[model samples]
Target: MEKLEEQIAHLTRAVDDLSDIVARQEGEIVTLNRRVHMLMQREGEREASSGGAVVLGDEKPPHY
Candidate 1:
């Protein structure tokens, strides 16, 4: 019974540690998602203002 209690305690501690790690990673993911959204919006606006040019190499822009 004591060994069982010890094992349960260790499992609980491990689960709590994993939960904290998941929470921290969730926050980081949210931050990274926001940054990616902002970058995408900026790139879209830049492309629109540039007349929808192709992103591929050697392709002339629509203005050509």
Candidate 2:
């Protein structure tokens, strides 16, 4: 019975540690998600102002 109690205590400690880690990671993820959202919004506005040009090539010389 004492051994069982010791095992349970060990498992409980591990669970608590993991829970704290997960909570911290979740907070960081939320922050990163917000930053990405803001950047995407800015990019969208820039694209809209640029008339949504899809061409991606260098301009040819006047002789061409």
Candidate 3:
């Protein structure tokens, strides 16, 4: 029937729209993951160079 056809067409379009959104989000997640990994590596290097000095929130730096 025509009504059934209309419903199917609408559902198909909705599914396609959702698929596009999911694909876009997947790419964004990949980019964010890479950035996080790079930041972690940079922080590790900084800590190593600083002689593993951990400046906690309640404490001040040695120069302070």
Q: Per-residue CA lDDT of candidate 3, range 1-64, in tens?
A: 9999999999999999999999999999999999999999998998899897765865887898
TM-score of 2: 0.76
Q: Model 1 misses residue 4 by how many Å?
A: 0.6
Candidate 3 wrong stretches, greater than 4 Å: 58-64
Structural similarity to truth (TM-score) of each candidate: 0.82, 0.76, 0.86
The lDDT leader among the candidates is: 1
Model 2 lDDT-worst window of ten = 53-62
lDDT of all predictions: 0.95, 0.92, 0.94
Candidate 2 runs further than 4 Å off: 55-64
Residue 3 lDDT in model 1? 100
Cα RMSD of all models vs. native, in order, equals: 4.3, 4.4, 3.7
> Which one is best on TM-score?
3
Residue 19 displacement (Å), model 3: 0.4
Top-down lDDT ranking: 1, 3, 2
- lDDT tens digits, residue span 1-64, model 2: 9999999999999999999999999999999999999999998998799897753565566697
